[model samples]
Target chain A: MIFRIAWRNIWRNKIRSLVILLSVAIGLFAGIAVLALYKGMMNSRVRTVIYSETGHIQLHHKTFKNDYEARFVISNPEKLLQELRKNESVKQVATRTITQGMLATTTGSAGVQINGIDPAMENKVSGLLQKIRVGSGFEPGKKNQVLIGKKLADKMKLKPSSKLVLTFTDADGNIISAAFRVAAIYQSENTPMDERNVYVQQTELNPILNLGNGIHEIALILKQDTATHTVAKQLQQKYPDLLVEPWQNLSPETELMIDTVDITSYIIIGIILFALAFGIVNTMLMAILERTQEIGVMMALGMNRIRLFLLVFLETIFLTLIGTPIGLGIAWIVTSYYHRNGLNLESMGKEMMSNFGFSTLVYPEFPTEKLLGIMGIVLFTALASCIYPALKALRLRPIEALRK
Target chain B: MSTVIDAHNISKIYNKENIPVYAINNVHLHINQGEFTALVGPSGSGKTTLLNLIGGLDKPDEGKIEINGIDITAMSPNKLIDFRLRNIGFVFQSFNLIPVLTARENVEFIMQLQGINKTEREARIQTLFRQIGLEDKMDSRPSQLSGGQQQRVAVARALASKPQFVLADEPTANLDTASASNLLDIMALLNKEENITFIFSTHDARVIERARRVITLVDGRITSDTAKVDTHVQH
Candidate 1:
């Protein structure tokens, strides 16, 4: 009977009740959509770093990290590469000969990390060939050729087929200079990282530096991220002398960004829930005040204070329960549509996004695991909103209530 | 007959600034079992205040109220609620039936609070509905019923618990003459047949004329207490 009365009481003022429902629904929808957008943005950043810059795992000579000197080369590169290629978990692998060098033009010189890469194997691991914005990436018979970032080429006032001098220390610690032609200029999402690094053919650069078929780094892209730690562990056990690092260890900044974005989304939802609570409290208080006389009559007829409190509390819960599902449904529909078609923020400008290594078009992703938590927050808000009003109902003396 | 309600020097005061305004002043009253009593007074005469004190709904300024030998004035608020639920029934001026509930539900509400079984509750409600001539409107909500029918539902609810006494405040104020006369006949019949005491505060001549004992108040003080000649009781 109490429940029946509570339920009926919710519809006493249909417009008032519906307004509360709509507010809760809209609040939840906005919170869910914002959370999805943030998740998509973070996912894009992590994928960009994994596929373009770090790969899932990297193996390097332990001493090569101190300073990418040509002398600290991996002694058995072919053996490790052959074993890794046979593993089912490994998708693609490439070897690089890294050295600190300076690229100089007629205008000026700038410090850079010159990566000597196998053109065929580097394409499989780094997707470097696809990011080439201009000029054919490396020719089959090409010698003394390099690919430079668009930013670096612009800074140097150089173009494709432009001759540039590369100076670095050889394996024997001798200062060697080689002139290489820029075969292509590539533009990647990370403008800063692209500007700091340049790539060249291993066949041509290794002979000039007296590298003798040795490599500094062995990078592998796994089919799935779940295999990264396992593959890294296997490689570590096989080559104890080498430093095998997974993507998380190779780039801790990206991992931290992912975690930080998750926390930030929760905080955003909390702010929305906090705001919605006040509206619910206001609506319930009005309802309580309006029904003062009726409540007074109930109390006079022997309904106790606890029952009166429950009547108000139950009414508020019913109102919220009605609104929350509608809100979640609206959120799901909007997110799903955007997730497929993508939300284009290109109008916000390319330079703004590129500076932060972000994509202009984001495919929003819904985190279904968070649905339970969202429902709990709404339930808690409903209960919290009812406290002041329900307490007021409890405080009503029968005599006074009857008069009102 | 045993005294059902004993109010000694009951007084209630309202505050205006720092001054005290007496609503009920040093009023003494005793209502015995099976008596049909009416408390008649004009506006601001404190008839409702005295009734509230007797019903244990409000505290008296300088007195005590005893119902069936228990000093309800000394009871805790929670205990008073329970005492009222089990011992006293109240009918408000506005027919105060739960607007959302049906007539049967309104009557069954008190029995449910007392934890009565459904069979017993239904049987008792059926008998009371028949007695109040509202058996046909048992399933009708307060809004669906007429003002007089709604009042009858409130009366049936008051008597549903088989309380020792009923306190009605202006129960017939909103009813027509015919409805008021029909309601008085039912109360008089119930008073004689079941020996249940009934006390009412009203300005209606119809209710006053029907009461076997009429107590008149002026300026918060009882001026006259008269017992009329009645031919209904054959003892």
Candidate 2:
């Protein structure tokens, strides 16, 4: 009977109840939609970092990353490469002879990192072959062919088949210079990386630098991204002399961004629910005030304080339970639509996103795993919001309330 | 007749901290079982205050009240509420039926609070509705019913718990002349048929004329108490 009374009491003022219900539904929908957008953006950035910028795991000489000195080369590169290829976890592996040098053209000169890469192995490991925008990847059986980034080509006023000079120190500490023709111009999602990196065939560059069969870095992609940490740990234990690092260690900024996404999402939803709680409290207080006489009569007729409190508590719970599902349903439809069709932010934030190495066309990822936590937060908010109004109902003296 | 209510030198003071004014001052009274009594007085009299004190809705300031040998004034708030639930029923002046509930549900609410089973509650609801002559209006909400009908539902609710007594505070104050007389006839009939005790506080002469015993108050003190010999003949 108390349940029936509480349930029916909410509809006493239809407009007021519907207004509260709508407020709750709209607030939850906004919170969930924003959460999905943030999750999708972060997921995209993480994918770009792993697949395009750095492989899942990178093996380097202990001191090679400190400075790009050609003397710091890994010993027995072919033996380790063969072993990595046989490992079930490793999908693809590539060896790189890297150097930082100055590239000069007739129009301009700029400092850039030149990567010595085998065309076939590097293409499999980094997917660089897919990023070509202007010309074909490498000419078959051609010497002195290089792949330059679109940003670098634009800045140096160089085009496909253009000739450029690279000057750097050799392994014996002597100055070395070579000329190479640009085979293609490629563009990546990251602006700074595109502006700073250029690639050349390892066979041509290794001989020019007087470093025969020397490898400075060995990078490998894993069959599954979730196996990155395990494979890196196993490889590090086997090769204690080399520096084995995972993608997270290779790029700390991306790791930090991924770590903060959860906290940032929670804070955003917390602020929204806090504001909605105030609205709930106000609505419940008005309901109680309007029924002062009825509550008084109930108290007089032997309804205890606990029953009165439960009545008000149940009414608030019903309102939240009804409103939340509607909100979640709407959020699911909106997020699923955007997740499938993609939300294009090219006109609004293309430049900014690209600067941060993110794509403008975002596919929002719904937080399916976090739905339980979201509901727990909403229930707690409803419970906390009902306390004040229920206490007000409990404090009413039957004689005084009846008089009112 | 055995005494069911005993109030001794009870007082209720208002604004006790600054300037104390008495609402019920030094009032002593007794009521017996199966008696239809009325507390009649003008404005500013303590009729309503005395009714509230006897109904266990308010505590007296200076003295004690005992109903059926239980010291209600000495009981805790929770215990007093339980005692009221089991021992007394209430009817208000404005027909304070729960607006959201139908007439049948309002009558059944008290029995539910008392933990009565469905079979007993259904049976009592039928009998009470039949006695009040509103059998057809059982499913009607308080808003849908007329003023007289709502009052009759309130009366049925008061008696549904099978309480020792029913305390009615100005029960007919808002009713029209015809409705008031109709309600009086129902109350008188229920009193005689079931032998249920009834006490009312009112300024209405119609209610006072029908009551078997009349106690009048002025300035928070009793001025007169009278019992009529020909009450049945007058009805």
Candidate 3:
């Protein structure tokens, strides 16, 4: 009966109450959707970094992790590949034999980093497979095929099936040159990674750096994120001479950028939550004041102050219960729509990615844990709004309330 | 047969403008069971304040008030509220029925507070409305009814609780002469037939004339206390 009375009393000023409710709902919904979008964008960017550029785990000779320029190529790629393929968690194991080299064409010569991998193995685990914009896929186990970044390819004026010679100092300090055809071209999201490294099938890196069957690093892809750390740990024990780093270590800037976004989104949402709380408090106080006489009559008729407190509290709870889901529903609809079409920041290309320290084309992901936090915030704001009004009602003298 | 209300040296002070005004001052009074009494005074003569104090709607400072064998002035705020719900009913001069509620709902309010079921509460409300000559108007809201009809609804609400006493503050003040007479007659019949006490604070001549005992006050002091032989009920 008290609830019935409170509910009816709330509608007496329909426009005012509705205005407050709508404001809270709008604020809450925007906060919820933005938070979700932030998380989604982070996951998509992180995914591009991990699967396309950085594998789940990378293994380097103990000295090369601290210094990438060190020529500590793993002496037994054949043996290590066999050992890694034995682990069931390993989805694909690819090799990278790299050196700082210069590419010389008839027109000009420029500096670059060279990475060699088996094309068949690279595609199974690397995101580069999905990023091939033109030309054929990486040719398998061949000595003359290479994949050049789109910007690098544009700068060099090389197309698929075009030939370019790579020149660099060998381990013995002798300059060597090798010829290779551009088997594919890739548009990299991040510019630093794009302009420097050109990918080749394992033996194609041979004559340019005077490298042989050995690779400087081994990249392992795992089926899921949980397996990444476990596989790294296992590989570390298996080869004590090599240092294994997870994808997070391979790409710290991406994680840091995502963390920054999460905190910034939180700061914005916190302000919105504060505004929403004030709106609820203002409206509820007005409601309690308007029904002062009715409350007095209810008290005189033997309803306790606790019951009166609940009457007001329940009105807020009911309004929030109805309003929050509507807000969440709106958030869900927007998130689902964006999740479908995807946010394309592709226009600025590598410069945007390098400046932001992320891949430009970001896909949003919605995980359960973060999305459900919105309910706690909405409920807490609603509950918090009722306190001052309920306490004031409990303090009022019955006669004064009736008289007023 | 015995005193049902005892107010001893009851006083109420209002702190307005930091200047204390004594609304009710050291007043002593006793009301017996089945008494039909009227307390008459002009505005701010402490009549409504005294009535509120007796009705457990307000407390008296520096005094003792015993109602129905309970020293109610000593009771806690919550206990006093319960006492009012169980033992006292009120009819205000403004006929402060919830404007949204029908006449029957206004009368049935106290019974609903008592947790009475719909069927029994409805029947009692119907009987009371018929007694007040508002059977057909039971479904009408207070605004839909005339001022006289609205006061009858207030009178019916006061009696719905079936309390030992009804505290009415100028209940007939808003009504015309005929409605005032009619309300007083219905109240008189209830006082006689049910042995319920009716205590009213009013300046209405019609109300004072119908009272079996009149207590008149001036400037917070009683000027007269007299009893009439009998009220002439206009048939």
CA RMSD, predictions in order: 3.0, 3.3, 5.1
lDDT (Cα, tens digit) per residue for candidate 3, span A1-404:
55655665667788987787677678867887777767776776677777878888999888865645526778787878897888788888888877778776676767888777776777776767677889876655555777888878878888898888887666567767788888888875666676778887666565455666767888888878877777788788888988898988888877677778877876766778778777778888888798788677667655676777888888887666666667767777777777788766668574766545465555555535754555666667777888988898888887888788
lDDT of 3 by residue, B106-193 (tens): 7776787777899998789878988899999988877899888888888888778788789988988888888888888999998998
Candidate 2 regions with alpha-carbon error over 4 angstroms: A104-110, A172-175, A209-211, B16-19, B229-235
DockQ of each candidate, alpha-carbon based = 0.73, 0.81, 0.38
lDDT of 1 at B231: 30
Per-residue CA lDDT of model 2 for A1-404, tens digit only, reads 99999899988888988888888899889999998998888888888888888899999998888988998999999899999999999999998999999999988799999899997999888788899999998888888988999889989998999999998888888988889899999988887888898999899888988889998988899999999999999999999989999999998998998778887877777788889889889989999999998899999999999999999988888777778899889989999999999999899778688888888988887888778888888888788889999999999999999999
The deviation in Å at residue B215 for candidate 2 is 1.5
Q: Of models 2 and 3, which has the larger TM-score? A: 2
Ranking by DockQ: 2, 1, 3
Candidate 1 versus the native: TM-score?
Answer: 0.93
Overall lDDT per candidate, in order of appearance: 0.88, 0.90, 0.78
Predicted model with the maximum lDDT: 2
Candidates, ranked, lDDT: 2, 1, 3
Task: Report fnat in order of the candidates.
Answer: 0.68, 0.90, 0.40
Which of candidates 1 and 2 reaches a greater TM-score?
Answer: 1
Candidate 1 lDDT over A200-287, as tens digits, reads 9998878888988999888889989888898899889988999999999988987888888778877778789789888888988899
Q: What is the CAPRI rating of model 1's predicted complex? A: medium
